[model samples]
Structures are given as structure tokens and as C-alpha cells.
Target: MTEGTIPAALERAAERFAAREALVDGEVRLTYAELARRVRQAARFFEGHERVGICSPNTWHWVVAGLGALYAGATLIPVNTRFTARETIDVLERAKVSALAITGTFLGTDRLAELGSSRPGTVLRIPVEGAEVPFDGVSEWDALTGLDSDFVSPAKPDDVSDILFTSGTTGRSKGAMSSHRQALSVAEAWGECGGLTEEDRYLVINPFFHSFGYKAGILAAILRGATILPQRTFEVRETLHLVEAERITVLPGAPTIYQVLLDAPERGNHDLSSLRLAVTGAATVPVALVERMRTELGFDTVLTAYGLTEAVVATMSRPEDDANLVAHFSGRATAGFEVKLGEYGEVLLRGPNVMLGYLDDPDATAEAIDTEGWLHTGDVGVLNERGYLRIVDRIKDMYVCKGFNVYPAEIEQALGWLDGVAESAVIGVPDAVYGEAGKAYIRLRPGAEVSTADVLAHCKANLANYKLPRYIEFVAELPRNLSGKVLKRVLREENG
Candidate 1:
């Protein structure tokens, strides 16, 4: 029946919900059949390619382009739209993508022009906002529609469907490869938990490049026949407007999302009564936040989940879970995963949905997944008697900065290139708005003078906005242990 893969799932959705509204992107409203036909038309453009990259904001185009690549038997590479031209080019070059679909301009920058020198043979400039200027070597996505394709070479269940890059502790990003079955399996599990239905309207505030938005938001909506409304960026007033205007039933994001909505002055001005289900995770959800989200925000169910890009949807809270439970623990293992506590309380997972491996990095993959088939997640957590999990700490130095994972090692590495840089240490500090922000302590080279502005400028050029340290300080020397390894714990203690 070819029913175990995402392409097969989309076909089923096309047949089962042909007349149902499948996607609602700004001015483009498409039903299931219309969405399917559009995906096929775009798929014809991706033929004879092995890997296709999409670097654009969330919209009808991102969905169609991503699915089109998969339908043409090409692995999808979703580049972060927040990435700088250098960072975006690095991902595209490393993946050796055969084609790329990017936005023309966003936030005053011409992204298509920025990526002009990229190696992709075929380029499609996606229309976002403002004027869509023509690029010399790029084709327009809007003009690529209406073509037909009779060729059928959709990916199989075991084929790698997407390569999502996640920054590692090594200061470089690693691409995690999820097969078709693994991606769709987690989506099915997530949809079943949220009780998604065609009658539901889903607001996707999370970025499309992220697993939360792609797997849980888009794929889950497709499987359960929910209507997807893709918001390019999250603004509090716009979110409220959409909730009231579209009668949004299912909304999921980090705890910060709900917190903002709760604290907004215009919250009561809009009719937010249709918000029913909210799936949140990434940072600790305060008990007060959960209660307020339910009673004040009018959400009937609020759940928390814990997972990384390697194996998304490992554990998630159930609808019947109490507010306290939802606030404290991520629910029991789902998506056919077995969660266990490894050495030093490190979280371990064995499942059907665990990623195949990191792209072209066997040694790294071996370190992540052991011979016993368990993926050793570098997180420390405790499981209750009922198997619910509460993440207490991270064994790795990675921290969540405003819902995005920021590796201090990366910033530290970037700092090494500065003229006066000698040694550096970065640690997480508590923040009221972002939950946690990076604090960098630096020691200059002997007799070298560098202003704070110099370091800040270097960081601004090298790192993404979320990866930039919120605070910086100059120190004479970094605290070290007997073996001369820098003691980051001492830094966090002294400063944080």
C-alpha cells in the first residue's frame, strides 16, 4: 500500500480530505487535493536531484518546496532563515545540494542575491514581502507552478527524508538524518496525542526549519487533516489577531510564547476562546504559566514534551495530565521509544524514530548511538514511578537561549579569531525574558588592548542573533582546575 512513508501519508490525506482546507498561507488557500497537485508540480522541478535545500520563511512555499523535494526522491535540507549568508552557504555547500529554494528578500536583506555564488545548479527565489527583484541566475518559485509530472520516485520508508543541522558541542553543526518512516512515525504519535482533526486550525509559530514546526506542526497536521496556518514570525499582537480571526484551535510553541500572550496588554482585547490544545516544551514551564494558559488563555489542554533533533517526540505529556504534572514532567515515552536513565542519570532512548545517523560522520554517530542501539542523550533527568520524566540538567554545555539551542563552544571558538583573544569561557545566565542568555568572560592576550566594541563587532559578524552572548565581561585570567581545564562551573557560580 506504500503507506509507511510521508509521501504515502500525504497521498492518503489527499484522498481522505480532498475537499478539506489543508493549508492557509497569507493569500494562498489550498485544499488537500490542491496542495497535492502543487507538490507534484514542484516535484517535477526537482527530478534527477539527490538533495534539495529550502531557505525561506514559513509559508505555502516552504511546505510545497520541501514536500516536492521529498516526492522527487531528494532529501530535504531546511536551512535556517536566520543564518547569515556565510552560515547558509556553509550548509548548502556541505550538503552539496543540487537545487535551492530561497526567499528573494527578508528583513531588508536580499537573501537570494546573498546566496548567488552557491553551488546549486537550479535556484528558485521564493516570494516573501516587499518587491521581488529578479536575480540573474535564479528562477521564480511562483512561476514554477502548474507543471505536471507523471514520474513516480517518492522516497521509501527507509530512505533519509531530511537532514536537519544541529550545532554540536564541537562548535560545528551536524546534520541529523531522519528516514521517512521515522519522521512520519513521530508525527503520527504527536497527532494522536493532540487528537488532531480536520476541524482543527493549527497556528505554526515555531520556525519551519525546527523540528517542532516541521515534524510536530506540519507533518502532524498533514496526518490528522488539520488546517495549517503558517506565521512567518511571532509578534504578540499578530498572534492574538490570528487566534481570533482564524479560530485557531491548536497552538504549540515554547513556554515563552504563552508567557508573552499572557502578559500582553491586548490579550483580553481579542477573542482567544478557540485555542484548545497547546503543546509546549524546550524550557521549564512554570506552574503558574500552565494554569494561566488553561484558565486565562482558554486552552483546554496544555502539554509538555522533551526531545532533541536526533529523535524528536521522545516523550510528551498527555491531555489528561494535571497542570502540576504538565508543569513538572515531560510525559512517558511515546512514538515507540524506550526511555531509560543511563550512567550519571543521563537520558537514553531506543526507538524506531531515532535518526539514522549524522551525515558522513561515522565517528560522531558512533559516539551518539551505542552498540546496544541506545542513543545517549547528553541530558540529565529523572523518571517518576509512572515513567514520566523531568529534565534536571544538561550534561553538555549547551543551553537554550530563547528556545534555540546555543552552544558556548561555538562562541568560544569564534572568539579565538579575534586579535587580542587569549582564552574565553561562556555560560548560561537566567533572564526574565529569554529564560536563559549567554554570558561571556574573556581574557585578552598579554599586552593586547581590545575594546568591548571590538569583541561585540566580531561576534555580530560571526554568529547568529540567538547565538550572540547577551552579556560580556573582561577578566584577567580564567579559573582552572589541576589539569588546567577551565572551570565553567566556577564562572557560572561567580557571575550568574
Candidate 2:
């Protein structure tokens, strides 16, 4: 594959598929030409800006600003849409963002004012909806949109393109700096591995703020010259309708989308035969659901990939991978990526896709990536003899039990396999006998009933006594981040 920048890739594809649909949202369809033009206009909007912050929903504005910022040779700070005013202000200050582009009065919050206070002269606000207004020295969104700038800032492989803030589930959020080359590398690699072509049409479900959503959904489709069906929000029936109506070839989402589709009664009525590839990750998926997609939904290819915001993407299970293995392992490490089990059994990664550094926090950067250049993933994993990697559990999530190591995922997986169990979360709780003991939180399927004693008895058959959860509690829903990852730290705090 020829190595080229993201803008170059999109430009080349636009030449081939100029009039072809690029992003389709019902009546609104953006062709490759239109997408390029919008991206260029966005780049023109950010001319002379050092740092531009974008806090918008999953829509054309987000993609346009993201690509535009990259083209303008300015660092982009993506503020989380769900963040409170204080949180939003925190991200802008940490990233030193001078300009901002937001959608729809930023959900009626005064966050823009809060951010403006930090950098008075440099603040530029662009509203995603309606005509942009000049607010506190910021240019109107439309005024910046029409500016003509012939300057095309060529991005090097190593130049910082975007800054993505962490979810801050455990602590303060840090901005991970991603370079143009690194982001493009992951998108291109995924395009090749998935055998993406000009004909494939992908439905974009994941939020574009996340690495998976940006690289996998928007950028990857651009590189492949494939069509993108962008959904502002995910609904089971609506997604099914789009997949059937557009003949969507690729469906990439977290386990929640799959679980919802599996439970939808209309799932049987929809024509999902067009779905060739279903790539999911960022959450643990039950093996039964994996099998059901193959037998019921007619997904010929279902893969699970594991990666973080800093690393972009590291590993994925191939289409040829055994269904059971795809259910177990997160494929092989992506091209230009290497994974090694550290002395502490933690998954350590080294690759070009690894983030350059954290914005304004060298200490946190150094803590995450060591002197040896290996990124400490803090994930417990083992590489099989066949070179497939299976993440056992998070290193931080593992607890000690009477001098024995207890992995929450091991117990959680066992619990999920039990009858009537839908989803489960396991956390370490303080115990008098042992320093810490495993506690399980469960959410049963609709109309399904199971007792704590029955769950414990079921786990006893699948797990060793040492790994058995000491306590069990049933909950209506488990605590999860926007990305659908269980926040075990929250569970531990609650147990305390």
C-alpha cells in the first residue's frame, strides 16, 4: 500500500468517486467532492489558529472540523460533548485551545464563556447549527466558512494533528496527542485488513471523538472511497433500516449495539444480509452473541479489536479467526505494532501508532510510556502460540486473594456464560479475611431470573475456588463510560 497522508488519501479517493455518496444521513448526502470542499472550507476557517477546540455532536460538522484542523496544520483539541462546563473549561485550558467550534448553543451551556475567560483574545466560536454569530471576538461560523485559502499545509507523519481527552473515569483527564501519520496509519491498516474497497458502504455508529470512531469510521471510509452512512445517534430499528436501505457492507459498533439488535424483534424482519463485516470492541461481548450474529443476523465476518486512545489501534481478530477465538482474542497486533507481556503480565505496546505525548503533561506522558519507548497498557493479556493476543483483564482491576492473583474478567466471563445472565461487572472489595475479595454485580436479561447462590454455584463449575467472587449483587444497570467500558473504579468506590 502506498503511504500517503489522510488529506491526500481523501483527495485521491475524491478524484475517483467525486459524485458518489460519502456521508448519507437520510435526505442529507455529502459526496466526496462536497466533503472535500467542506473540509477545505473548515481548514480555511482555522487558518493562523494554533489550537482549535471542537465540541460537537457526531455529525458532518465534527468530521469537517477534524479534517479541516488537520489540513490547516493546527493542533485540534476535541472536547467531550458530555462534559460539564467546568470539565470543558479544564480541557480547553490544558490543551491551550485558542479557538472553538461547537454545535447548537453547545447544548444550552455557558461553557464557551468559561473557556473564553481563559484565553480572551484568541477565542473563536463557531456554531454548528444556524448562522454563526460573532461572540466575544470570535468569528461567525459562516464568515469563516467562506474564506478562500489556497494554502495547503502539508502534514508530516510526525506532526500533531489532534488531541483527544481521556474519559477521566479514574482520575483527571489527559489529552493524548495524535500525529497525522499515526492516525492515517491505523485507518489505512484497518482498510487493508478489512479488504475495504470502493464498493463497501459503512455505517458510522461510534462517536467520532473516540479514536475508533475517528480512524475506523470516518477516516477509513474516506481512504477506501467507500460510502459512509452517518447516524447522529444509534437506534436499533433505525440502524437496521439504514443497513437494509443502504446495503451497508460494514457495521462497526460496540457490544451494546449488537446486544440491542439481537434483542430487537424487528431484527428478524430486516434484511441484514448486506452486512459483510461487523467489527466490535471496547467492551466484553458474550460468546453466545458472537455465535448468534453468525447464525441469526447473517454476518459473515465478525471481529473484535482492542486499542486505547493513546495507541490508536493495536490488535484485531481476523475474519478467518475461529468464532470462539474471535470471541476470546482481540486479533493480531495491527501492522507496525508490537505487543509484549511485561514482567508484571501487563500488555506493553510499541508502535508508530502510539501517541507522541500528552498535551502539556510530560510527567503523565512519561508515566504512560516508559524510557524504553514501550507504552504501558496496564492490561493483563497473554499471547497464544499462534500469535493471537487475549486480554485477560485490566491490571488495575486485578486483586490479590490470600496471596493468589484474582482476575475479574475470568470470573465475569464465567458469570456471563451462566443461564439468564445478561451482563456482569466484577470489582475488588475490602475484606477482613483477605486484603481484598472479588465482588460481582450482575444485570440479568429481560424476563430472566437467577439467584446469587445459583450464580456462585455456576461459577464454581467453571472457575477455581480462589477465583470465585466472594459477594454478588444484582443491579439494573452497570456503570459504564460513554464508550461502553465498565468503570470498575466506580464499582470499587461504591463497594467501599
Candidate 3:
């Protein structure tokens, strides 16, 4: 495969696996050669655009358009499908996007009309099945893909590949600019860490906009010549059906996804024997869940990885790791990365996969990456003698209760062991006695009842009084971003 750019990697994949199945969406399949041909054609259409925005679901169109933009030497910007009109406009304007490739409608929302007149670029609508959306002046997908397929723009390793906007938990989201070299490095690291083979059928449920889905999911698959089955959204029944139908070999998502599948009544009805590898992260994963995924779910290997948008996949557990290590730790640093702890117990990373900088935010970029080139992750963690890293919590998520520092991730991990608790989040709230106390928001299993007193009693047995939650509130569900991370800022704002 080519060393730096995604389009170069695509060209190599097409040569090696020309007739192999490259991408699969519902009723849409493309071989590597066909996919490469379309990408080249779309590249010709995007020849003049400096920055191209892609707003679509996890489909063949999204993958093709993104790679095409790269091939045409345009920096790709993936817009979150869940963003509001104002948020979308903000991204388009901030990125200085000159063109957009978007689906007509996704999940009952007319994406074109949502941006409306606020968009500052040319819009290109990707036609979806059974959708007839009208637009005044926009290019169609057919017209773009019908262009000449021989044109290929030159892109260097230092060129910006994509600008990924961070989830605005702390404040306004900053776009993390990643170069072609960084993107290719992360993709190769993920594939090597996961032991992905060309024979594996990868089911990508993560959103295409996120670094995990785009770089680790699609780009990694292309690097290894693995067949990509892109799912628009996560649905337990639908995923189960796809797993059986496609004989998927590699499946990765958050811990909640596997938990839901284990709890499904119809899980046994589906033939999941083809599932061999599973990778998950984003929250506290219980050891029991890891064991169940291996023993009950029939997965040969279950791995846990840790990374952020700035560095795509820094640490990941190997296939030989035990369930406890995989659950309790985020694994050692991957090859080509140096992971260390700061003076305040914050995790710091230095590697090729580290992003170039935040787009248009020099101050924020300087604050993030220090003079020594270390990316301050702002996550509290501990490195064991064996070199495994255990994430305690976000440095901002730590709170003082009665003069003792308390980490919400520790409390959340303890809560996961509770019988009826399906999911939980702890935020520091104002307390009369202590300076700040933790308030636990919990979502119980369906039809399982557990009161606040019961939860407190369980915590008393498992945790110290200072570390125990001061208050408990039962909720139907926890608010999560598109990436499946609990919106702790939302919880803190609501309950603070």
C-alpha cells in the first residue's frame, strides 16, 4: 500500500484486491476496482475545491466522497449528521468549506433544507433510495461520479487529510487537523493492533464523522483489504440480522452495545458463530461483561482500546490479554507511541498519530500540545509496573468531597457491578457539608427495580463513605454524544 495519502492507499488496495468486495450497504455493493473507479471520477469533479464537507450516514457514498476529496488534494471535513442547523453552518463557515457532499435526507431530516441559505458553499446532493428531495441549485451524485476517472491530484504526507471537530464538552468544539501521514499511521496502527486480515468482514457501526469510524473503521479496513459493511445506526435486532446474514468476522462498538445484545431475548435466534473478534471502549467495562462476551457471545477475542480525536488509537489490549486486564485497563501504548503520566496524573501522548493542530485555533493548539510535543490528554490515569494504563477519569471530572479527591469513573465502575444498574454516570454536585459531592444518575435494567437506599447500601459495601455518591437519581437513559460517550457536561449542568 502507498505510504501517506488515503487515495494512494485506495489505489494499492484496488491493485491487490481488484475483484474483492470492498463496501456493502443495504442493496448496494461495490468491488475494490469499482470503488476505486468511482473515487477517481469524483476526484475529477472536486478538482478545484480546496475544502470539501461530507455530511452523510455510514454508507458507500460517504466513504467514496471522502476518499475522492483526498484524491483531488482537498482537505475533507466530515459534518456530524446530528448537528443542528446553526452548528452545521458554524462548521461549514469555520472550515472555509467551498463544497459539500451530503445525503438528501437522513433519519427523516431534510439535511439540505436544514442548512438552507446559511451554507457558504456549493451543495452536492447524494441521492438515496426512495427519497425525492428538491433543491434549487445543487450538483447531483451521478453527475460527479460520471466525470473522467483518470485525473489524480498530487498530495504530500504533510497535507491536511481531514479536520475532525471535537465534541464540545468543555466549550466550543475545535477542529483537530490531521495530516495524511498521521491518518495513515493511525489506520495502520489500528489494523495491526486488531490483527485485522483481508478475510475479515468488518461491521462499522461507529459514525463516519468520528475519528474512530473514519480512520480506525473505514481507513483501517481499506489498509487491510477487509470488506466494509457500514451500518447507519446501532440497532440490536438489525445488527444481529446483519451479523448472521453477512457472516461478519469483526464487530466493534461500545460496551453498552454488547450488553444490549446479551440482554436481547432474540439473541439466541441469530447465528452469531461467525463473530470472532470484538473491540470496545468509551466507558468503564466490567470484567463480567468481557467474560460473557467471550463465553456467551461466542467471540474468539474481545479487545479494549483507548484514544481521542487528537490521537486515534494510542493503546489497545491484545488478543492474549485476560478478561480482567482488558476490562480494568486501557492496555499499554501501541507501537510507535509514547504514553506517560503528567505531574497531575493526566495522560500524555506523543506519536506519529498525534494530530497536526486545531484548525484556526492557535491558542488552543498551543495549550493542547506543549513545547516538548506532548499532547496533554487531560485524562487522569495510572501506569502499572507492567506498563498497562488504567484511566481513572477526566482531570476535569475529579471532584473534592470532604477533603478527599473523588473520581467519577471509579464510582461509575463500582455502580456497574450493581445488580439492576444497566448504566450510570456520576457528576460532582454542590453539597451543604462537603465542598462538592457526587450525584449518581443511573439507568436500571428494564423491569428491574432498585431504590436510592438500595443503591446507597450497595455503595457502602463496595466504596468508602467519601467516595460514595451523595445523591442518586434514576433515569430512563443517559444522554450520550454520537460517539456513545456519556454527556457528563449535560449531567453536570442539569444537576450541579
Candidate 4:
């Protein structure tokens, strides 16, 4: 791997594979040279900006804007498109974002207008799937073209490249800071493990807001010279059609992604033989699912991985591993990283790729990474005789719903805003499509007439779509211990 910054890597890729296909989005296509020019144009557009925020779905515009910020020596903060205005504003404020690339009125929601006067300095409104509602003082996203005199700032390997916010069990989200070196190193490691090459065409269904999509999906494609096809949303038929139509060779997502592909009634109608590599993780993986993915989906290589935002790619299965090993274990520690069990079998990792620290929070940083540099992950896992890690329990009350972590406390805090509900508890339950789904238990105030529809409506407005609970049940009283703490175990058992 080249010991250079992301922008430098992009420059190298442009020169090495100038005419190679780099991006494909809807009707637009760009070669590596053209993609580099587009990124420079975006960088020139954001000349004076410092920290940049992107709050849109996966698109070619998102790719250019995000890379443009990094290329211009600004810290990139990718905001979840599913978040409401309030939630998005919280992250922007936390990061002190000076420029923002937000889509105009998407899917009947004017995210820009919703942000109101609290909006950041510069806004690049990308016109996506919805009518562009009139908003004041915004620049056109697609109109950016590099001026001959525009200067692009260079970034160092150690400079922070991105600040990705992740919710914790404490109900507040923390920004995980990664330097250019860490991001590029992890992307290269992932690409090498998957054997991503110039011959491969990757369909990135993962959202760009998360590491799996941005780093593993897009960044890896840049480093390895794979053609990237961004799908803004995941639908059963459309996804299958993309695979068959584009001859997508490399696809990585959660187990649920493969499950839906297998369960699709029209699975027989599509020619998915071009699929070469498939990576899935972040939730339970049944051996049968792995076997079926290999046998039915016709993927030549299938691997599972275990990672958190703090350490992007801790453990991952190699291509040669068997289906049973791939299903049961999350591979061994990758190169340049060491994984060991701390007290009570807690998984601890030490690596150059681990996040530098939480943004602007020294105390929390100290608590997470120890004096010896081992990050004390709150996940419980057991290493097999051959050192493959199998995650068994999460000490934090968090669950993976469709590859994204859903902390119950975050949803519970959102539910607290409802008018009628006195208290609520959220838990994860098994789902056929989404590996796990959220189930909320509401304790209404005396004589309160809040219905399930009301709870769902409030959640839809405040929380991201992934955080919304699929099940809502009202309760007279929540089971509590003598100390007045809600017994979540009881709720899980009763739910069962």
C-alpha cells in the first residue's frame, strides 16, 4: 500500500488508469481522469471551506463532494440521509461544519428548509429524486467546473480526513476521527483481502454515510481500479437487475442482503453468474445462509467480517475459507492489527487503523483506548483454537438492524419526545429480511390515548428510518427491579 494521503492516492490512480471506468450513476459515467477532474472541480467550489458535511443518499455527486473536501484539506463528515433536520443539525453543529452538500427536497421532505436558519455557511444543493423547493442562498451542486486558476490544498497522511458519528449506549453520538493514513490503509487492506482488481465491477449498495460503503465500497474501488456503480436505494428487483445488467462482480453487504436475494421470487429470472465476491456481516449469520449464498447466489468467494466504527476492519474472513468457518467466525486479525480478549472475554484490538480518538473528547478517548493502545471494545466474543473470533454478545444494549447499529437508548430518547408516552424501551428482534428489527415497548401516562400509529409517526419525524421500531406495543407498566431500573431481560423474554 502507498503511504500517502487519499487525494494523493486518487492522483496516482488517475495517472495509472486514466481511461478506466471509475463511476457509473444513472445516466452519467466517468473515467478515472474525468472523476479526478470532477473532484478537483468540487474542491475548487469549496475553496475556503474547512469542515464539510454531506447529507444525501449515495450518488456520483456525493462521491465527488466527499473526495473534494478531503482533497481540499477539509475534514469530511458524512451525514445519514435518513436523519431528520434536528438530527442532521446536531452532527453539523458538533463538527463545526463550514460547508454542506445536502440534496434539495428529497422524497417529499425539504431537508434544507427543515434545517432553517441553523444551516451551515455554504450549501451545495444536489437535485435528486424530488422537486427542488425554493431555498435561499444555495449553490448548484452539479454546476461545479474547475476554474483554471483554482488551487487545491494538499493534505498530510496524519491529518484528519473524516469524522463519522456513531451513537453509543449512552444515547449521545460521538464522532470517530480517522486520519488519511488510517482510512487509506484500511481500504487497501479490505481490497487486498477481497482481491479487488481493475477487472471487477462493484455495486455499492451500502450507504456512503457508513464506513462499509465509503471506505470499503468507494475508497477501495478507487485504490484497486474497480468500476463503481452506486445504487442510491436498495429494492429487491432493482438490485437484482443491476447485478445482471452491469455484470457486478464484487458485492458486499449484510447477511440480510443475501437473504433477500435468495428469497426473491424472481431470483431465477436474473442471470447473477457474474457475481464473484460477496462479503456480509454485522449480524447473525446462519451456516445455511452462507451455504445458500454460495450455492444459490453463485458467488465464488463469500466472507464474513466483524468491525465497529472505532476500528473499521478488525477481523475478516479470507477468500479461501470454507463456508462453515466463514459463517461461524469473523476470521482472524488482519495484518497490522492484534486482537486479544481482555477481562470477561471482551474483544480488544490494537492497530494503526483504529480511530485516532473521539472528536474533542479526551476523557472518552482515554476510556476507550488504554495506556497500551488496546481499544476496549464492549463486544463479547470467543476465539476458536485457530484464532477466528465469533461474536457472542454485545455488552451494550445495541443491535445490528440492516447492517447499521441501533442503540436502544437513542430510540428511547427519540420516543421520549412523544406527547402521550410516559416511558418506553426498545429492543431488537429477529427479522427475516433485516437480520434484526427494533421492537418498542411503550408505557403510557395514566389515561393517555396514544396509539401505535402515533408512536410510529413521531419516530418517523424525529429518528432515522433505520432507528424506527417495526413493532410498537403499549404496556400498563414496565417491569422494574427494586432499584427502579427497567428489566430489559424480562421484556426480551416476554417478547419471545
lDDT of 2 by residue, 99-217 (tens): 67766464555456555456425444555444444565665555655667454766665678789888888799988988778888898888877888889998888877777778888
The per-prediction CA RMSD against the true structure, in angstroms, equals 11.2, 2.6, 1.5, 11.1
In the range 105-218, model 1's lDDT, one tens digit per residue, is: 887888878875664889878888866766677788766665774546557888889999984333578999999989999998999888889999999988888888899989
lDDT ranking of the models: 3, 1, 4, 2
Candidate 3, residues 1-496, lDDT tens digits: the string is: 2357788899999999999999999888999999999888888878889899998888888988999899999999999889987888899999999989988777888887788787646777887645565677888887875688997668778899899999887888899999888898888888988899889999999999998899889999999999999998898999999999999999999888888888888999999999999989855787777888999999998998899989888899988888788889988898478999997899999977788999989999999999999999999998899888888899899999999999999888888888878888998999989989989999887778899999999999999999999889999888988888888999888864
Q: Could you tell me every candidate's TM-score relative to the true structure? A: 0.81, 0.93, 0.97, 0.80
* Residue pairs in candidate 2 whose N, alpha carbon or C atoms collide under 3 angstroms: 316-331, 317-331
Better of 1 and 4 by TM-score: 1
Q: In candidate 4, what are the lDDT values of residues 1-496, reduced to their tens digit?
A: 2348898888888898899999998788999999998888888877777799998888898999999888888999999887778889989998999899998777678788789899987998987875575666888764686354244557889999999887433457789999999999889889988999999999998889888899998899999999999988778799999999989999888655675677678899999999999988743465666788889999999998888888888898998888879977888888478999998678999989889999899998999999999999888788998889987556666788889977776677577567665567788988898988999988765566898888899999988888889999888777742212356777777768
Which of candidates 1 and 3 is the stronger one according to TM-score? Answer: 3
The C-alpha lDDT values of all candidates are 0.84, 0.79, 0.88, 0.83
TM-score top scorer: 3
The model with the greater lDDT, 3 or 4, is: 3
